[model samples]
Target: MAAREYGQYCGVTQALELVGERWALLIVRDLLVGPRRYGELAEGLPRIPSNILAARLKELQAAGILRRAPRSRVVVYELTPYGRELEPVVLALGAWGFKAMGDPRDEQVVTPDSMTMALRTAFRPAVAAELPATSYAARLGAAELLVRVDGARLDVSRGDGPVDLSFAAGPGIRRLISGELAPDRAISTGVVEVLHGRGDLLARFATTFHLAA
Candidate 1:
């Protein structure tokens, strides 16, 4: 568990003590997506040292923030009900951190879980409420996602299906989501490549999932 104890008794202090270690909240972040087998988590977090991942998992399990359970005869790790409450906190943190995300480094690679959460963080329910339903199949680096927005609800999943727009982009898609780049410009500049479906919906997709600066 806890790396160290803060002498002061406070809610924030307690919260940090519970999940302050590096990669702890990230474990929670992935589990928030859904249950993941140990190998799945390892694959998603490529940089995490095997021992560190195991240690964090044990710490989180000890804190009751997550648990291991059987799924299709394989054990998977999932957040506990108590841990699910961190969704909003994680989203808020992601938004705050996004302001400092100038660009991705050469070593940084986007994972499906991270991309899913990023889309969730940028999703604009109010704006989407006024737009028609749309679906987008986006491939960012090695991540592929099926994003559907109906009214104010957004559903994101791995893999592909029938979609209004299917495109591929690297990390530059952040510019699109953050409203820094217009859809036409993104397409024209190769920031996004339309593989299938209507390219016009990219504008709608931009409107639906946006984060101001």
Candidate 2:
């Protein structure tokens, strides 16, 4: 699986050689959230060619980054302990790229897994440590997420649950996350719709999940 050799005896070169193939790190990103069946991965990455997905999966498995294992009697792909070490790297990279993300393209669609990772990337544990615990039921594009911030810990998952705030946002939500739009301005400007909770909590949400531009 070391097909993309750089002829350099360096760790960064080796790392890229293992996962530099297009769509490889994305597969790792999705699995970092949780185990996913093959079909689930396909669903998350709608644009990935089927053959490419299969080939990358095989390559990653060969690299010992991920493994297929039984989950509820069905096989699912999950990152190994070694692969789990990539979490911080992925999150840091996401934060770095986020600074340059001005707006979404016409064809770009947010997936649950991607949204989950985005939340994780922008989470401010130190800020949340000073704020009261809060839970949010957030709908971003087509992704529905339950986000809970308890002091310094943040938890996110799919589906709805008891939440202190519920809101829906579109791609413009990035403006709020980037602190370009204030919470009050976001709600008043129709960038965010308060569905079923105190709108004030949206301010808390903004503070807790923020990535400075």
Best by lDDT: 2
lDDT of candidates 1 onward, in order: 0.91, 0.94
Per residue, candidate 2 scores C-alpha lDDT tens digits across 43-82 of: 9999999999999999999999999999789999999999
Query: Model 1 off-target regions past 4 Å?
Result: 1-3
lDDT of 1 by residue, 1-213 (tens): 433788768999989888988999999999998999999999999989999999999989999999999988899999999999999999999999998898888888889999999999999999999998888898989889999999999899997578888989998998998899999999999999999988888999888888877
lDDT of 1 at 181: 97
Looking at model 1, the pairs that clash are none
Quickly count the clashes in candidate 1.
0
lDDT of 2: 0.94
Give each model a TM-score. Answer: 0.96, 0.97
Q: After superposition, how far is residue 51 of candidate 1 from its true place, in Å?
A: 1.6
